[model samples]
Each structure stands twice: as structure tokens, then as C-alpha cells.
Target: MKARSFRFFAPFAFALSFSFLSAAPARAAGPDPDPWFGKDKALHFSVSAAIAAGGYGVGSAIFDARGHALLLGAGLGVLAGAGKEALDATGYGDPSWKDFTWDLIGVAAGLAVAWTVDLLVRGTGDTHPLFTAPAPGEMKSLGPSGLRVVF
Candidate 1:
């Protein structure tokens, strides 16, 4: 096509294409448009994990029992997630079960990591260091005395 004809055709074609796009039905906004794996979900997960791990460390320091520490960590994590949801329910933001689910998963992951670190640092035996030899009297309990393994 000639330069002049090409210029005229180009504008007409562009306008025609846009007209078709505009004719399509518009999407209605209701629930969140964010995907499950979006940045928002990542933030939620990371924040909950940090909270839970911090709580676990603090709880471990305050209480001798691992169970108490576990409860503290899980409670803090759950409280954080639930609090956010409750705030969203109050019209502060969009409430999402997906975000809460991610938060729960993060909490679990954080607790697992913290628990592993504790075990490594504190050791399951009388000695604090994981690689060290067990105390003399403690060696007697090493065998299959009331121990069970499941696959």
C-alpha cells in the first residue's frame, strides 16, 4: 500500500480492534482478585512464620517443657492470622481463607524449624551439644528400651 493509504488503514484498524474489546462484558468486582500465590499471600505467610518462630523462642526460654513452648508458638501464630481475618471482617481489608491457610502452613514450618534448632542446640540427651558423648548414666537408655519406630 502507498504511505498515505497505509496511515489511514492503520488508524482505522486500531480503532476497530479497540471497539471489539470495548464491546466485551466488563468483569464485576466482588471478592479479591488476587491469586493464591500472589505477593500478598507470600507476605502473610512470611509474617506469620516470623511471629510463630519468635514466639517459640521466647516460650522455650520461659518454660522448660517443650509442650508449653509449642502451644505458645502455635497460639501466637493462630492469633496473628485470626486477628488479621477479624480485622478484615470489620471492613479493613478483604478477608480470605486462602491467606489464613497460608498463615497456618507458615506457622507449622516456623515451628518445625524452631523445634529442630532447639533439639540441635539443647540436644535430646543430658549433654547440651548434639555431637558430644552422652553422660555415663544416660548411655544405658540408648537401646530398644520401650522405644518404638514407625515408618
Candidate 2:
């Protein structure tokens, strides 16, 4: 009886978790088509990808539902990306869709990395990635070379 319950619960948990994670990135305001297409785009892409990845990791750790975590993370990442874009558009920085796209990509990458790592770790034991807000300095690359600050 115990084993039967476990079996049913496990699949339900997995399905629920996956549904949430997969839907996260798509829930954000549709990507702005105008700004995500041009110059200095690589920077934007990298940032977004990192945000996604970071958010997934943190989200998974805090929430019982894996999907919820992914959703929250992706949502936060999109907000960050949009904020950056809006700032640039207002002449605060360079408005580059390239950058926003990169941010999204970062979020995705973060999610993938976190998920893969979590799966591998779970098989060995019940460990998850550490979660903490990234330092301000950790946010962007420095100089024309786009070198990240390592600490």
C-alpha cells in the first residue's frame, strides 16, 4: 500500500513540476520584437540566459512545486530583461533587443543547468543548488571584452 501510494505520488509530482517549469518563460509579456534584433546582441543574450538559469535554481529550492519555481524564476528574469530594455530605450543605456534576447537565453540556460544538476544530485542524495541573490557586481560584464567578474 505504501509503495503504491509512492508510485502514484511520484508521477503526479513530476508532471506537476514539469508543467510549471516549461510554462515559465512563455508567461512573460511577449518578447518585444523591435528591440531584440540588433547590435551588441550577444551581451543581451548572455545576460538573459544567466538570469533564467539562476532563477530556476533559486526557484526550485524555495518552492515545493518545481514548476512554480521555474515560473517565478522566468518571470523575474523577464522583468529584469524588460527593465533593462526600457532603461536603454529611454536613453539610460543602449537599447538592444540583442541584450534582452540574451537575457532570456540566460534564463533558459540557468534553468537547464539547474534541472540537470538537480536530477543528478537527487539520485545520489537530496541536495539542491544553493540559492542567494547575486551580488550587484555579479550582474554584468565589465569593459569592452565582456569579461565577467569572478569572485
Candidate of highest lDDT? 1
**TM-score of candidate 2 to 2 decimals:** 0.50
lDDT against the true structure, each candidate: 0.79, 0.67
Worst 10 residues of 2 by lDDT: 124-133
Residue range with the least summed lDDT across 10 consecutive positions in model 1: 133-142
Residue-level error in angstroms, candidate 2, position 12: 70
Candidate 1 structure lDDT: 0.79
Displacement of the residue 83 alpha carbon in candidate 2, Å: 0.6
lDDT of 2 by residue, 1-151 (tens): 9999999899999999999988876545886555645545666666676777778777665543455557877887799889988988999976765576677777787677766776676532223223333433433344578765432
Best-performing candidate as measured by TM-score: 1
